[model samples]
Target: MATVKTVTTADAAAKLDELLWVVLWQPLGLPRDIRHTLSLEGEEFELLAQENGQVVGGLVAVWTGGTEIELRHLAVASHAQGHGIGRSLVTEFYRIAKTKNCERIHTIARNTSGEFFRMLGFQTAPGQAPEHPIFREHGISFELMERFVEQGTPADCSTAARSRGG
Candidate 1:
């Protein structure tokens, strides 16, 4: 059985860095400039999946202000990819996001993951505009997908609501 745990302290950060960043992202050209950005943030969390004490997969998210959590990284062992590990990671992140009172979560998924995120009920932004944080970054231009905790509060709606009394 696999157990999932939240990364909360420096020790957890070490484990996470070993499994997720060094082992995975570095091989895929995620850019070294983003390494400092990946360091533990005051509002971020790492969800780790371990079986019999050996880490298998991870998902990292950071609260991006005003009740939104942004997925920084997510991956399952290449050998573990087909066994629902990815889905479980996202679901767990959603559970954590709700617990943290975040009204929504977002991620800038690579083209390869378009279908994966779609299966999890994430929708791509309908415009070419760089409205999402992930897009405003200096080195990437991936599709941004967002999942909302409340049905009617679309990304644009949240901005609109702030100008009203609702």
Candidate 2:
């Protein structure tokens, strides 16, 4: 059985360099410039999947203020891709977001991962313009997908109560 755990920023600061290269940089063919600049120093959340004491997948995301979060990186070791590790990681993240009262979550997904995001209920943001500046600056031809969280809040019937009291 695979177990998922949060990767602390302190541990990520040291381990991300190796994991990113093996799981994303080489496999995804990310540019060296981008890989070199990736840092977990200021990340707000991260998670990793472990089996037999070896990490099989991980993700990093940022709290982009005001009830919004953006996923920065999500990678599963090539050997572990089809075994539901990615799905579990995302599910855990969604649960965390709900607890934090996040209203929405989004990610810039590459073509390969777009379907996976869609499968998890994310939809392409409806707009002709890029929703984020980084998309334009990087010249990355990717889709911006988002999902709104439905938070249950107590219903207020203040006006009716006041009228009845009067």
Candidate 3:
């Protein structure tokens, strides 16, 4: 079974860094400051996942309003891809965000993960918000996606469900 939890404190941030590295970042030539900034305090919310006491995936969310949430990242271990770990993690984030009255969610995603986000009800656009720093990075490219929620269905929720029998 998989479980998710919110991250708090600098120590947990450090742990999340390790998880991001071991599962995604380091293997992809990303930097560690990504983890440091994720925990820089005043973040609206974050969710971390674990299986058998080890981190496997995570999704970080920040609130923009009563009905708007920004998905900073939704990462899964390479080995855990296609296992529903990412979906479950995001589902859990939605449950929490809903409690906080967030009915819309947006994400700026890498080229490869846009389809995954779309499957989860996140849509893609050619341009990004001005303050999103998308153009700051030179080599990397991204697309912006948004999902509007109505009665628990994500605005961009595609037909893709976890491949599990559930």
Best by lDDT: 2
Model 3 TM-score relative to the real fold: 0.74
List per-candidate RMSD values in Å: 8.3, 10.0, 4.8
Candidate 1 on 8-40: residue-level lDDT in tens? 778767776777765455665576546566554
Per-residue lDDT value at 149 in model 1 = 62
Per residue, candidate 3 scores C-alpha lDDT tens digits across 1-166 of 7787888778666666676667645654556665565442334676777898877887777776657788877788777788888888877776666666677777778767777776776666546543324333533457777765556544223232332111
What TM-score would each prediction reach against the true structure? 0.72, 0.74, 0.74
Task: Compare candidates 1 and 3 on TM-score and give the better one.
Answer: 3
Candidate 2 per-residue lDDT over residues 82-134, each given as its tens digit: 88888878877777887888888888787678877776767788655244345
Q: What lDDT does the true structure give each of the candidates?
A: 0.69, 0.70, 0.67
Of candidates 3 and 2, the better by lDDT: 2
- Please identify which of the two predictions, 1 or 2, would achieve the higher lDDT against the true structure: 2
Ranking by TM-score: 2, 3, 1
> Which segments of candidate 2 are over 4 A away from where they belong?
28-43, 127-140, 152-166
Error of 3 at 19 (Å): 1.7
